[model samples]
Every structure is written in C-alpha cells, then in structure tokens.
Target: MRIAHTCANCGHDLSRLCALIDPVYGLPIVVCPRCREAVVRTSIPVRTRARQARRLVVSLAMLAFSVLLTTGFAGAVIGLSSVVFEQWVRAQRNSAAPWTHEGFVVAAAVWAGLALTAGVWTGAMLAHWRWWLVLPAWVAMLFGLIFFVEVQQVVEFIAQGEEIDVLALATGVVQGHSGTSRVLIASLVPFGLGYAVGLPIGAFTRRSAARRMWRRRRRIRLHRRNA
Candidate 1:
C-alpha cells in the first residue's frame, strides 16, 4: 500500500500531485500547489505527521472557541441594546417608536465597531496572520443566529394557534425583513477587515521584540566571552 503524504508548509496533499524522483538524492518528491513547497516523501516521519494532525486539531478548536465567544458577545450587546430601547420607549409612552429601521441601523453600527475592536485585540494576541479565517466564523455565527431566531418565531407562532408555512416564513425572514437581514450580515464585515489590518501590525511588533531580545542576548554573550 502506498502511503499518502502532505506538505508540511501548507498542508496540501502530496498524493494528488505528480511525484518526481530527485536527480541528486534519488528521493521521491512532490511540489505542493498551494504553497509551492517541495516535499520529500522519505523526509517526513510518522511523528511529524502526528504533530501536524495535532496542530490542525488545535487550530480547529481555537476557531470554534473564537466563533462561540464572538457570537455570545454580539448576542449580549444586541440584547442589552434592545432592553434599553424598550425601557426608553416605555418611559416616553410612545407606541410608535422609530425602532424598526433606525434602531437596526444603529445596532449594526455598534456591533461592527465592537467587532472591529475585538478582532484587533484577537489579532494582536494571537500574532498569526490568517485573517481570512474570520470569514468562516462570521458566516457560522450569522447562520446560527438566524436559525435560533427562526425557531423562536416558530414557537411563538405555534403558541398563538397560527398556521405555519415554513417556506413562507423563511421567505419573509429573508425578503420582508431584508433591512434587518442586511444589517445583521453587514455588521460582521468589520471584524474581518479589522483582523486583516491588525495581523500584520501585530506580527511586525512581535518579530521586532524578538529580534531586539536576540540581539541583546548576543551582545551580552560576546561581552562575556571577551572578558
């Protein structure tokens, strides 16, 4: 049985690529299309493969945790805002409060700003430049939120002894509430944008600090040697 191999650099499967024998060392090699790294078949040990698998698992776990934290944070913010708005409307004794459109736009803007701040902090803390990873988490959060709201609405409708049309409800949620849906979707854009902006800055700052420490250690060692 032929063993499958993956590129250490980018995790691209080597088995899919055409294998070539190195002329100098007579070793089987494959060039990874994603990162263009030449992976030698024999050079990869079982331990290395296991380590890579562990790293992948850890990365996936981190992403999942990030998504949950972000979703919860966003939910809390929106919930708080809604409560405040309701309280204010109640105080004013206004039946027709301008919360339908204006409230949603304001909430979206606030969420976007909060997301951007959170993304920047996360990027700086992690110091890894894979900004596009935020998009998948954002999409997951959006869908999860939608599913939750739909379920709640369905439950309430049933409680009211209303006939349910799943298709029509979904259509109404997407089209009738287009403004709300658009705001919800658009609010997540800033986080990704902020992460992209922050990652490079964070990485550069980290590298600079590391270089300074290295140079300081090198200088101390040279001075001691001379002494």
Candidate 2:
C-alpha cells in the first residue's frame, strides 16, 4: 500500500497526480507541480534574500549588545583589580605609580580580547551567521562605536559655544580619519586571529546539532515504516 500525499498550499490530493515532494531540508512538503514551479520561480529567491538580511541584522545587533555587556563587565573587573593592585603597590613603595602606562596597555589588550570573543560567539549562536561574516561585523562594530563616541563629543563641543576653528576642525577631521583607520586595522587583525579558532568551534557545535536532528528524523521515519 502506498501512502497518500496532499498538496501543502491548496490541500489537494496529490498521491495520484503530478506532485512535488521535498522532505530533506525542512518540513516535509507535497504540492502540485505547478505550485512547486511557482515557488521556485518567485518565493524561493525572495525568501533566501529575506532570510540572509534578517540574519545579518540579528548578527549586527548581537555584536553590539555583546560589546556593551562584555565591555562593562571587563571595566568593572579592571576597576576592582586596579584598586587592589594600587593599594598593594603603594604599600610596597612610595615611588611606584598606581597604574603604569604598560599596565594600561595590557589591560586594554585583554579587554579587546574579551569583547571580540564574546561578541563573535554570541552573534554566531543567535544569528546563525557564517563564521567568516563575524570578522567583518566585528570590524564594523568597532568603527561604528568609535564614530558614535567621537561624533557625540563633537556635538557637545558645539553645544558648549566653543569658537569653531574651521582649519583646525578640518585638520582634526583628517587626523581623526587617519587614526581611526589605524585603530581599525589594529583591532581587526587580532580579532581575525581569534576567528580562526572560534569558527571551527562554532561549526562543530552547529554540525553536531544538525546530526542530532537528522538522527531523530531517521528514527521517526523507521518507526513510521514499521507502523
């Protein structure tokens, strides 16, 4: 005895007629050949683009949230550590600086590491974004945050009624652009290195999830076959 399949859209019986069946990728779908052709022609490409755009938006949002969250956490940790270390250093010697410039550099590097790692992982898990995409998103997030902070400061200067020096402003803008470019490269390079390790870890996790789902579906099919 053959199992009957029904059309997904029109609910027409398709078991004895020309039908298209697709069960591998997502939900099992049975439809008339005409409907399948129409879907191929119109809905599929539109849905694909829409899905990609949605995922990209979600990834960017997650990246932003993770940067804010992890940066706050790192800042809190650094603040506490600084206080404790400062006390210890002060007790040890009267001449030692509380936080050295070298120490500040090290702390900044650590914070960057934390921020990038947290952002990439959270965004990938939530958005199902490709691993390669995360690096670009990370770079964009850094530039965006930096731009926003600088732009806000510029606006505040204007609000304070400071005399605007057009030449000075132009020079600052040119210099700022140069500095931002350097910062972007410095930040993105280290973050991209992390991506090498992180990408595989995320891929393995997603692949394992897919395997489990496939196994479950296979079992269901076997059970139905027996029934």
What value of lDDT does candidate 1 attain over all alpha carbons?
0.64
Output the TM-score of candidate 2. 0.40
Please, what is the TM-score per model? 0.40, 0.40
Question: Ten residues in a row with the worst lDDT in model 1?
Answer: 77-86
In candidate 1, which residue ranges exceed 4 Å CA deviation? Answer: 1-68, 76-109, 121-130, 156-163, 198-227
lDDT of 2 by residue, 6-68 (tens): 544665555454322334533333446656521211124565588779979997997788767
Model 2 residue 59 CA deviation in Å = 13
Q: What's the number of clashes in each of the models?
A: 0, 0
Clashing pairs in 2: none
Q: Pick the candidate with the highest lDDT.
A: 1
